[model samples]
Target: MIVHFQDKTVDEQSRTSDLPIHIRSIKDFRKQKDYESSLSDRKKSKLDINKKKLKNNSSAKINKKIHKVQVYNKASDANFLFAVLETIDFNSHRPSNNYRYPQCVFRFATIIAIIAGRYAYEFLRMNLRFLLPTIQTIENNWSYQPYKEANFRFEETQTYLSSNNCQYVFVSEDCSAIIPRIEYDASLDIFNGFVTPVVEGLPTENAFRCTTIQQLKNLFETNAYANLVNIHVAQPIADSNNALVLPTTVLAAYGTDHKLTAIDILKRWLIIYKKFYSRGIRVLGFSTDGDPKFLRAMRLAANFFVRTQILNIYNNTLAFKVKIPSNWMSWFFLGSTQLFLFVQDGVHLCTKLRNRMLSKSAELTMGSYEISMEHLHDLIRSTNKLDHNLSISDLNVKDKQNFASCQKISDDKVLNLLLLNDKYRGTYNYLLILNLLITAYTEKAIALSDRIYCASIVLFYVRLWRIWLHIERSPRKNTLSEKSKNKKKDQSPHFITSNALLCIELNAHYLIYVYLLIEQNVLPQSIAESTYLFSSQPCENIFRNARALSGVYSTRINFTIMQFLKRLNKLNALTELKHFEETNTEQKIVFPVHHKIKRFMDKKQSNNNNTKLTSFNTHDLEKIILHAYEIAQNMANFVDLSNSLIKNNMFNIEQSSKIAKQLLHLNCLTESEIVDVDGSTDDEESSDDEDLDTYNKELADIMCDGDFSEDELNTSNSFENLQGTTYSGVSE
Candidate 1:
């Protein structure tokens, strides 16, 4: 105990200092030094080491306290600092740059970050803690890829199409106005913005080829965004439950100032058609907004209905075919082909109808029939235009695509009010045409018989309507309403806006198409197969999305074509990623759009239990057509050529009666002489191709509408089934 005498003063001073809990035993050991000597020789040695080895020495232990802390990387840690700073798992040090995220994870992160912007992307990245790729990484991955116009992405496109075995497709084209600006595409090495000449459906790459500055200057001076005529592919899938279809943009070419002619359109269509045909995909139809040129093209192609072959008997059976029945069935196919139907956009039809309804110059009056805007004005004044959707703002002439306005005016509620007095039977007949047609196209494709019940009357009603509104009519001055602001320009019906001709053409061609399809056995006559599903809706959605991605203000809608192209890849990337992430069984679309207005509805197979299903009468479609016209004529006997609004009736009522029997229009059976109608020039129907998602809701609904159980189909044995009335030309 006296061994520390020499250093006693120093030890005493050092003892006052605080020591770690682990070394506290040493403090007691200093004070009780004699206790170590009292222990055995072995115990004394053990005490100096792990004191537990010494007997009765449990107190001489080291209490090492272990602290628990949570650690998080920098990126994720920053985001939570605002609200959860105390609880967040923040990393004390920066993470290693060597970590590589999985391909899918980074791609998802990149899409989210990019949409928000570079600044937002960085901010997100800090919160994601290196889970997202850097902004530079995404930029590098998306480095300049030129969109080859008319250069179909055969390899890339066939990816989903082949998977779903999609066979039928429609080629839809519409022009969206673009910002007229000249820009050099480095890849194509040509000035873009001038209308590119389309040769065989392919944009001529060298149209603006220039090495000199003067040529470039000239190109710019004449530059127009050239009306971005985007050509997209719409595949109307037969039946995949409630699967959706995404539009595939195959060609993006600008147009010349003048719209393409029927000949040009056909040539381009045939070229594009062949490309798909070679790929084992069959094109069923073409769709567009109501452009006169397109209407002309469709009429030219519809020549298929008139060109028929005589049925020859051989050995009490069908004879061997000689002429190309295939070409006759189609507008003009090089070989065997399907029917080439033309579908106008339904939304456009509604708009066109609205335009006519609000036309200031012309009044909807011919003979005893009348449906004028003045009538609407009377109704509006009565109701104060407050209790209904109709309003004065709906008549803005500049807004041609005003579907909302059209719907409001065409609303059943508004029409019921118009017919409140029951004095406007003819007016109601004319007003309901567009609605019936639209509901037929966009909803379920009811039986031809059912559709005809509503459509045929409307078809004949237009014949009378057109005869009265035609610009060539005599005594047009006094016939014009007294309220006309101008006599000539205002009273005279505008060619496109009149829609009297358009209505006739649509219903007539629809009859012809139904007749031809029923005869061909391609469509199930027992039920109406509304398989015509391709529309410019896909193209419109593309424009809508382009606007959204640009983050532009609502007012400034114009943008360069290149800017539009750049957004496509990014969109495609995000879409592809979304598809991979979600459980989607939809065909045609690699990626679906997230649109607000798109409604998802469950397709219910209509109950045939309540209604007796009638057998499709495939025998006499001409008879059916005549009946439709006859029915309309019977309903309204006001249409007499001699007593017409025009006073130049040279023929008697006898000739007019003969024309009515044939179910022909007034143009052919004119008073001077009966003119032969060119079957090719006949018209067809329209589609309200809204968003693809909106379309999906009704897809299976329409698909199964025509599809009935075996028992339902056998309910009635019609002449069409028993007599086998399928066209010999189409069958051959």
Candidate 2:
């Protein structure tokens, strides 16, 4: 058994006499003996062993904690804070001397941070703590300053990331304006002594508005800001002797003094133009009108900034020649082309106004300015090709003579001269003449003679005669055979014959003349009458020559006439002629057949009542009588047939007339009926009511002929056929 005690004694001498013994006083034990040394030596060894075990355990614990921390940090940490920090440095502050920033990577990171941090700021803020170590490390190693200014600088940096240099200066000025508001007294009275009794007085308020131009200049001079270019200062034209007359109220507000100041500013800025251009900067200046002073200022500025004799000369020349700048000229040219192609001139301005209202710069009305610019651009671009440079004074003696001689000339030279008149007055007049011709035709008011004359002239001009002559020549090659053999698959057949060309030309001439007549309201009423006189000739003669030439049938001619009639009827203009009075005052002309027929019918009736004559005379009379009877029978049969078809609604009036005429040509009607006065029937001699009814019944039977059964045939056809066949067919 082991025991631990403050001192070790030789009471164990009874068991081990030779063991070392140490004695000491309880209070001064270390001074008493070597026992203190032995105990100290043993305690030092045990302490060394415990110290070694503790060091190992602590190291293991620290390693485990570090590993857990690393896992947590890896899971939650974001690079967004570093991105923000880098963006601030890149945009707000210039880079340090030692640290070379990766520009593209910085730009990419800045964009991502701005976009991603939009709704994830809490996550970003939490992870920002992790970046503090990195920041501190950077500060220690590279002497970097992260938070030298207030956090607002970071905010400002973000705000100005995508903003222009001018926008940043404006933002600062806006901030300065708000700062004054915080110090202003809201309750201060405006009217100190008089206003309380008479009316309610408002508090005096002083609102601070920053002068941005001055503030921006101060910022640029004081701070290491990015280069600013194309700074525009619009000074109003004032009611002063030096001020140029401007077109707007805003321009009038800035005094002439301010305009002078602006000119000076422009001149100074121009001096830096070359410097700016070298560093990728562009500068521009614009004003409402082409002011001489402004142009002078631009010239001076260009000379100062560009720093070259050639550029100065170019600038001076451009300022003098082009009242507006080239950018505006290009804009005008392109815009005008678009406008001309899509919009008619008169309506274009109104369309532009509507479009301008919806644009971002709605307050500005620059449409007319744009149009002028476009015109200038067009003039500039076309000057070389079209020789638009030729002025009125440039006309030679021959040109003047040609122009003067156009009045009496009808040659191609005159036509070309008129077309090149530049004023377009002659073209307008010629178009008007064409319009008059068109108006006259459609109104159908020109005389047929006049129409024919105009048509002949039109055909000559349109080359219809030449086209006809060409058509008279036959094809040189067999196109059909070649096509069938498939020698050339891409080859098309030539189908445009000379006749077809002539017809087309004729049709065009007719259309043009018609257009002129209608458009000019020049149609004369006598035109229709003349046309009718020419057209009313017997169809046989009128179409005979045409049909023989064209190999067209009479039926086609009739069809064409019918179509023309239909078209005329549908035209309301021709309907007015339906009520036209026809007056024929000439004496009635009689035909020789009329007198013979009248005498024969009268003599025959008289002879029927006389006594029987000699055999030879009786035979002759019988023969004539039989011939007359045969003719009467044939006429009756024709009339019966016509009446039959008409009664059954199978024939119209025109058809019946045609049938009656055919019968007459066959010598079907007897002299008595044929000689009936002025084609009138005798009241008593004509078929009586009973006879007419009998005739109609027989006619109906004949009309039905083979189609009707025995029961279907009426008395008209049966009786007529029975009576006519015996007299006409048998006797003849």
Candidate 3:
């Protein structure tokens, strides 16, 4: 019997002995000197020695030697090689039937083969054989229980996956057991409890039935079938499961086996096509091998969305061309697919022709459209055929010349010519033409507005005539002197001559008449209220103002100040007007004023130029008006001052008395001296002194009252006592 102790007690035996104690007194022990002196002596001795000599010495050489060295072992390399071999082995036996292995292993192996100088499975297996021995040893001895503490190492190498203790399971398989297998294992273990029994036999039918039924059930329950359809149609090679099925199906369908002929593959594809079509699903056409059967099936199943794999007929000796059935072409080629692909491909075969047609149509619609005949004439003229070809051609000489001249007309001029025609008259059409002209001008790409240059000249002259009319109606004031003494002065000879206005107007009229003659085969109506010549209200106002300034009104104002100033120096004005003169300078002076004016007037006037009555006509007119306005404003200031003096008694009869008083205050003269303002000498001195004082006082007042604040005095009494005294005579 073994005795156990819970609360059991044990008796202890004690041994008694006394030991002698030793003690030392602090006063009896003597303290030694610090070790610092010895250490300092040693350090000083070392520093005082010759460094170079010491370094060369054997002792220093021994001290400089490395203390430790890292050593490489063969075991590390062996481990690395082993890991690489294991990875290879794992990849080789990836256990496709088992779900334990990651689905990406096959993909990874394919990637490795592509990158690692291998293409086939046999090549990979051959290379991996050399590394298998080392991997087997590691795998056999690998501890599964202490997996976390496993110590394995490899050398520092780029070839192996790792150079340290990295544990990796190369191959893993599913270990699921069925009920019958589990029961059998339990019965075998019971029977062979003491002795090992080898239980080997064929698998029972029940087990097969169970597995097959479960697998079929799983296939039905999961979306694997639907996923397979999707892989075959929507995205062929995008899914892993689909990718796995694809290669097998492709090889089986196209295989050389007895059951898998080309026709057989076609039949299988047709079956799949019918199945998908019955379910209202669409199948993708085969992209790799050009299988006609697949294409036929696709066309039959979905005629509207058919895709044809074009055969390389370019290199074929026997050139083959197929005239697609009319209905087929109309259904597929002319359908949305071509349009869709055209948009997707970003290039259309018909783009150039379409653009050309569009351009021509736009031009014709805009009224700026040039006839092809005119373009042909232009081509002829550019080739220098105007002189030589006219005689050789069947066309009449005059007709050829006319054609050449018409080609010279710009696009805008052609459009304007069309616009001038009553047969093509419409406000909407005119606006459209204007918009097209503006667009052509802005783009600068098309030669749409080239002919418009001639039309622009006419427009320019029309603008000038309208501007002249405006100036003549509203005559601006001319300040020749500050006194406002001259109410009337002879108009400047330039203004009277009417050459400038006439030149602009005539140029406009000539261009318009030319356009009319070329376009309508008739001269424009009289320059009054004709359909071709309509003046806006502003133009009429300008004419009115011009006539008024021509001495028709009693206002007695100067007309066209710029013209007046220009006439003051005839040679300079004439030089400025030279650009406008169509004929010799001597001939211009001989023309009557009315004739000159008519020449300046545009032949065909449009109301568009003068939309508003007050707006300036041209840049020159605007500048002249601005300058004249500034001068008038200055004169008004002077007039305002003169008017203000009347109420202040500052410009009244007692002017001399006021001057005398101011002079006396300034101390420039005594009261008696200032009173003697009659004598020539005294009067001169007094006037001079008074003028100086008044100027100084005025300057001070201007400085003080410059801002014109309300606080400033406006009292009438301040200047009332100084009657007849001019502001200039006031003393400081």
Candidate 4:
């Protein structure tokens, strides 16, 4: 476990993803040392001594020598080096000289060994100094049972969490079972106390059920074989800050194959929440991923109180009956203290949306107006010179210029096909559009407000689609106005086509809903500003770290507990290191371990620690606010945005004609790419069909019914339109 200086604290959260740090593998280091020491030769020498003693046992002096040699060999076999080897069964099934491990297997084993070796070496080093007493040490000193310390620590952590008023905890649960290979007699038969087993490595009819740890011990010669389900907790220390603290408390653990239901999971969750809530700690929500069964259970648990007062406060009912995948959730869960929000991870949503687009199952959104996989393939082929003579031809000047731009970008390699997955090509095209939008903000070419406005509009479009899909799945009919007096003759380049215009209008309608939500202050500041809070990636990240630290040598449950504690310690240490860098903490603690200390951990200890104080920057907040206000300008008057969208779609010809007159001489068609309108040969048709088939192939079979109705215009009246007017249209 890592130690943090007591006097320091974390002040803020960072926006950037944490860099993954790689520590040297201790197992490999130990293996190298063992190889150098020639343990194999020592084992052979010991065997030779045994043989000699058996031959010369006739003499008393030789008998004494034999006894001493036997004792030494037994002790050597039980030492750390051989014990480590035994853990892996390496020598038991030595590989032939010609047999070599696959590159992946070797790499994985090396990594695992490194981690295990680090923990083992650290434990030994600390134990030798009598400084850091582990559970084993405590158990040795006390008369408690196996799980007593764990239980006590869990209760202690709950008390601390209550005092801190920590809420919005992220929970992750996973199950690990005893592997069949690890069980010594996986195929063994047993007839209980009355009969001898006939076969080895084969189970008898009576041995079907795993009743106790004693059964595992009988099978594996050790009590380490057991299945377990573990639950972990992570909570934010401050709502205004992004610093999350991982507590070393296993909220609940069940024996493997325990018939635990969603209610069981919820009961445990509520127990933790209520403990804190009763003490004034307000838990707002939970974030978890993986295990659809468990998530479904959680959904059931959340649905139990759907009609509760907290949930009823909102005008619209939030349903929780949707299929719970890794990232997407159907509804919010309600609790006593706060309305619990279920997050569908944004990163995964992006991937899903991209995939939907690639498969052409994408509900024909703004980004997919004219882009297709054929275009992407053509660009790739042209750029790679596979079709060096490919050129834009046989088109009008407007079409030719548009094709030329596409050709130029293709030739310039703006999209790298080699770096992208074929299955995610559609997702790629959408991100290409996002890349442009993000670039506009990052480069400061567009105001942060404009970028955020665009992002919000995009999100509103997505949310609107979700709402429609959730409630019903049918396209709405919108009568095309043949004699409208206020429609734009030529729409902006971005919405040049009818479909693009319609999608944008539908999006604008939903933007009103989002504006109302902002007015209500229902969203977390992070979500309201950047709209990127819909990610469970952080929890996923924590799970990843947990898995990496849980070495293969120990029982999964024990290792998981150890790994979680170590992670909590590491995070605490990191927090203190940052705090100490800012302030002069006179009191400090030092811990020496085998793993190379990080630079921050190795900072010089002194009254004034000489490290420069780096003040936390909140410039992102300024950018977010700037973007929010910019979007609020047009969104404030939903009528103006509605008018622009309507005119662009030719729903109001008079307004459209006035805009068209202003751009009468401008090159409107120059920006629109021409599709395969040119006459195609039989070969070209075949090629196009083959490419289309690739795009049509679905990576995942589960496709949501994406059909939605957004043509209705009456929904906007219910939402309040803020007052602001920086009148401008969508970008070309």
Cα lDDT, all candidates: 0.47, 0.25, 0.23, 0.32
TM-score of each candidate structure, all chains considered together: 0.63, 0.17, 0.15, 0.37
Residue-level lDDT of model 3, residues 1-732, one tens digit each, is 123342232211111112222222222232222356677788888876766567668565574443211112322323433334334446556543231222122222322322221224335545654322221222232121110000111110100112111111010000111111111112112110011111111111122112366764543443111100000111111111110111001000000111122223333333332233223222322221112332222222222221221111222211112222232221112221110000000011111111222232322211222223233344345545443242223222333213232222223444344344344322223222233223322221222122223223222322222222223322555322321232222122112112222222222222222222223322212111211111111122222322222221224333221221111122111111221122222212122245533442332122224422222122433243234323322322222322333333333213312422221122110010000011111122133432101000111111110011110111110111112211110000
Off by over 4 Å in 2: 1-45, 57-281, 284-732
Ranked candidates (TM-score, high to low): 1, 4, 2, 3
Worst 10 residues of 1 by lDDT: 704-713
- Model 3 scores a C-alpha lDDT of 0.23
**Model 2 C-alpha lDDT per residue in residues 395-418, reported as the tens digit of each score:** 222332122222222223323433
Model 2: what TM-score?
0.17
lDDT of 2 at 619: 33
List where candidate 3 sits over 4 angstroms from the true fold.
1-254, 257-266, 273-282, 288-732
Candidate 4 per-residue lDDT over residues 355-458, each given as its tens digit = 33344333332321333445545554556545333343311223321323333333324456522445434334344444432332222223323444564444
Pick the winner on TM-score between candidates 1 and 4: 1
Number of the top candidate by lDDT?
A: 1
Could you report the Cα RMSD, in angstroms, for every candidate shown? 15.9, 50.5, 49.9, 31.1
Report the candidate with higher TM-score, 2 versus 3. Answer: 2
Full candidate order by lDDT, most accurate first: 1, 4, 2, 3
